[model samples]
Target: MRKEETVDYHIKVVWHAISRMYNQGGAMKGITASSGFVLLNIDQDEGTPATKIAPLLGMESRSLTRMLKTMEETGLIYRERDTEDKRSVRIYLTEAGKKQRDFSRKAVIFFNDKVREAVSPKKLEAFFDVMTTIDNVIEENKNLDQKIQLIENE
Candidate 1:
């Protein structure tokens, strides 16, 4: 096979493995991954405004709002009106959210172990670096029209 075809095949295989792991895992249910990720990200940057969280996650504000509402109903997160900015709400994980975060951490460790068992440490590290680079490249290539649309929709 040509080099490009080989690269595409490997990318598909990696994505499939990741999808399967997330879907089958107890802690990281496929449907809830986005909410979990947003929760974890908010935990890392506590007190971040809700508006900012959606953009950082590359998701729409409406979708994030729905996710937040679900999480709040589940007792996983709490939103408080920002003291300095009454119109803006800040997100914070509740006790249950912390527990979810712990579960996600363990799930990621389990997933990493599975990967390590299948691939060498060096290869895993390389794969991680390559994926990060690809993400960065995509972010950097955002066009003016896309940016404008994102802002307009917000």
Candidate 2:
């Protein structure tokens, strides 16, 4: 099958397009798509734990650390030691970060609303279902490579 005809290829292409769109939008606010994503995942009420932000954003911890440092340097975020867990740190948005988060939220909502207006609700639901099924299938097969082996007797 042609690469363009593959499901993974299409998914990757669509995702890259979406990421580029977000990055373009984010650039206006001096942020990247990745930074905006991390900002959105952080809780607005109480601070999010430093350890949890990476998982919430589906990011590597080392990468997160760098982003967090940049945000901190830019006065967008600050870290505090958790009162309950002395070893743990919580990340809190600065006033600037809150503003950036609001911008990010509005941008995302606008994009979603536009897509919703263009796509039928039924089709959107099916799209979500297909994505969920793909995730489940991939998750279930994660150990397949380690567990399965095919060989021919010589």
Candidate 3:
């Protein structure tokens, strides 16, 4: 296969692996693919705002609000008015949420260990570098949509 084809195939494989790991619950049932889980893992203690999490998760604020509300209803997380800024709401994991976070951490570790066992350290390092480069390029190109729209109006 060509280099580009190889890259595309590998990207798809990686995406599938991540989707399977997150979307498919292992021992725990009822857990679904959610930005809330990722946010909980990243900010176990720190309370993050809904606006802040939306950008980080590459989701719209409205979508995030709905997700948060669902998670809150599930008793996974809770929101409160920020002490410093009453207008801003901050999110934190409840006791149940913390247990879910722990389960997520263990599942991630297991999946990562399996991947590590399959790939050599050198290959893994190179893969990490390539993924980082791809992330950077995507972030840089995010503004291209606006540029293209501006040119189209000319």
Candidate 4:
């Protein structure tokens, strides 16, 4: 029942720590963690559809639209209209974006490497399995809301 014992609390605390670390590192390079993630999600060679980026990051389209606009103004990314479809757009990283994305990628790899150094592969696999199960439960709408609704119904 204690907050420290809750699954979400630990996940959130660790996530916030990671976010702060990423933000600090990214700030020096004139990008935020969010922007770096967007850059990484973009396809390097062919570009990625504008519509697909939001879902990949679990973000709303409106928020991504604003972020994309800022990225565009900063010369990190460019939008291209599809040749056959006027309404469809693709996002491509500029040289600067690619550089930042690489940095982000390296940071993530370094973090993972450190974790692997500290933890056994078996434990890491168990951790990943638990996280995946939690994600699947939430995605399937089998979380707290459903339990609360069921209690109310009864």
Go through the candidates in order and give each one's C-alpha lDDT: 0.77, 0.90, 0.76, 0.93
Clashing pairs in 3: none
Stretches of model 3 off by over 4 angstroms after superposition: 1-9, 146-154
Candidate 1 vs candidate 3, TM-score winner: 3
lDDT of 1 by residue, 122-145 (tens): 998898899899778677876856
TM-score of each: 0.68, 0.89, 0.78, 0.90
Instruction: Evaluate model 1: give its TM-score.
Output: 0.68
Candidate 2 TM-score versus the reference: 0.89
- Distance from true location, Cα of 44 in model 3, Å: 3.3
Backbone clash numbers for all candidates listed: 0, 0, 0, 0
lDDT of 4 by residue, 33-135 (tens): 8998899899999899999999999899999999999999999999999777889999999999899899999988888899899999999999999999998
lDDT, residue 93, model 4: 92
Q: Which ten residues in a row have the lowest lDDT in candidate 3?
A: 33-42
**lDDT leaderboard ranking:** 4, 2, 1, 3
Which residue ranges in model 1 land beyond 4 Å of their true spot?
1-17, 27-31, 144-154
**Candidate 4 lDDT for residue 153:** 98
Inter-residue clash pairs, candidate 4? none
Clashing pairs in 1: none
lDDT (tens digit, per residue) of candidate 3 on 1-154? 6765786688988778786768777335456656435545447777787668877766777887788888888888888898999999888888877778777777777878999999999999998899899889878998978989999999
Pairs in clash, predicted candidate 2? none
